[model samples]
Target: MNKLIAIMNRVLSLFCISLSSILVACVIWQVFSRYVLNSPSTSTDEIARFLFIWVGLMGAAYTLGQKRHLAIDLLAMKLENQPGKQAALKLIINLISAVFTTVIMVYGGGALMLKTLATGQISPALGIEMGIIYAAIPLSGCFMSIYLLKDLLDNLTDISSSGTSTL
Candidate 1:
């Protein structure tokens, strides 16, 4: 499990880095074309927007897996030495996050992508299928779900052993 999670973390990190690099390049080209060349590239703006979405979503998933995502731990801090309660709280939090990510980002985003594809929607500037750009939503949601599952299982194990939450 640890190995799988480590592999996932590496893949997500690479994915986000690649997308971010492309996004930066696109923005640079757009800026250079607009100011230096006196003409902006038509597709760079749309491409940058799409890449931004992918990079942001994947980066978030990577951060979540790294346990580096922002979290308010006031209640958790209060729990302190109560390993069982803290573990329970962590489990509940992971469960809630899993449900929300599945329902909103996965299901809803999938539906939106399918509907757009069905309508043959395309981006104006890039002439690319809009559904392709929207694919990031459900993909990131799935990644988040995986991380949440791992956290959930870890919390469960901690509860069984009366250990502090590691998530």
Candidate 2:
């Protein structure tokens, strides 16, 4: 499992880096074309927007995977002395995250994607199918789900091994 997550982290890292590079290049080209050439490229702006969406979503998932996502840990801090409570709290948090991500992002976003695809909706500037762009939502959701599962399992293991009374 660790190996799989490590590999996923590496892949997502590279994918995000590559997408960021492309996004930067697109913005630069757009600026150059608009100002220097006095003829803005129509496609670059739309391409950059789509790329930004994917990058932002995937980057968020990657951040969560790294355990660097922001948290309001005041309660956690107050429970500093209680490892068992901390573990339980973390487990509950993971469970909640999993449910939300699965239902909203994965299931709902997937339906949206399919509906757009079925309707043959296409972007004006890029002439690409919008479903392809919408795919980022569910894909990122899957990434988040995997990371949450790993966290949930780890917390369960901690609670069990601690041999402390269950909350």
Candidate 3:
């Protein structure tokens, strides 16, 4: 199980890194074209925005693996013991986050894809299918679900290991 988690983390890391590089490359190209070449890409800004979205979504699972999400710690104060309460709070938060992601993935993703497909719209520069780009949402949601489940399991097991202690 630990090995599986490690592999998942590594895969997520590589995925984020690769997507980030694409974003960075696009930014560099946008800058050079706008300033140096004096020929701006009309679609550069939109593409950059999309890439930013990709990085944000794709990096989520990796951040979860590292426990690097921005979170308020005050909730755990309700319980007496720090570790157990923290674990419980984290599990709740992760579950809620996963559900939120699922909602966005299902509705927002489907709407975006449907709109683009129906309107015959495509990214100006790449002319890529909108569904291809919009796929990031559900894919990331799935990735996040996996990470959240892992976190919940790990936290619950931690509590179990601590031996039915009060908190």
Candidate 4:
């Protein structure tokens, strides 16, 4: 499981790096085309936007996997001495995050993607189906859920093995 997670993390990181690099190149080309060539590249602009979306979503998933996402942990830190309280708080937080990501990102995003697919709408400049671009939402959501589940399992194992919690 850890190995799988590690592989996923690496793949996601690579994806983000590639997407960001492409986005930067696209932006530079756009600027050059507009300023130097006196003609903007419409396809590059749309491609950059799509790449940006993928980068942002994938970066978020990568951050979540690393447990680097922002959180207000003051209360958890304060309860460190109380193992039971700390465990409970951590569990509650994980559960809440799981539910939110599952419902909003997973289900909602999937639905939105399907709706767009059914509409058969194509991007103005790229002429690609919009649903393909929107896939980043559910993909990121799945990645987040995977990380959250792993964290939850690890927390439970720790709590059970140590007979206490130390979040």
Write the residue-wise lDDT of candidate 2 on 1-167 in tens digits. 89989998999999999999999999999999999999999999999999999999999999999999999999888877999988888888899999988999999999999999999999999899999999999999999999999999999899998777355
Evaluated at residue 58, the lDDT of candidate 3 is 77
Best by TM-score: 2
In model 1, the runs with Cα more than 4 Å from the true position are 163-167
Candidate 4 lDDT for residue 157: 74
Tell me the whole-model lDDT of each prediction, alpha carbons only.
0.90, 0.94, 0.76, 0.90
TM-score of each: 0.94, 0.97, 0.79, 0.93
Candidate 4: tens digits of C-alpha lDDT, residues 1-167: 89989999999988899999999999999999999999999999999999999999999999989989888899988987787668767777888989988999999999999999999999998899999999999989999999999988977876786676544
Provide the clashing-pair count of each candidate structure: 0, 0, 0, 0
Candidate 3: which pairs clash?
Answer: none
Task: Specify the highest-lDDT model's number.
Answer: 2
Lowest-lDDT window of 10 residues in candidate 2? 158-167
Expressed as tens digits, the lDDT of each residue in 1-167 for candidate 1 is 78888899889988888988899999999999999999999899988999998888889888988899999999999988787888999999999999989999999989998999999999998789999888888999999999999999988888989855444
Query: In candidate 1, what residue range of length 10 has the lowest lDDT sum?
Result: 158-167
TM-score of candidate 1 relative to the true fold = 0.94
Model 2: lDDT of residue 98: 97
Q: Can you list the residue pairs that collide in candidate 4? A: none
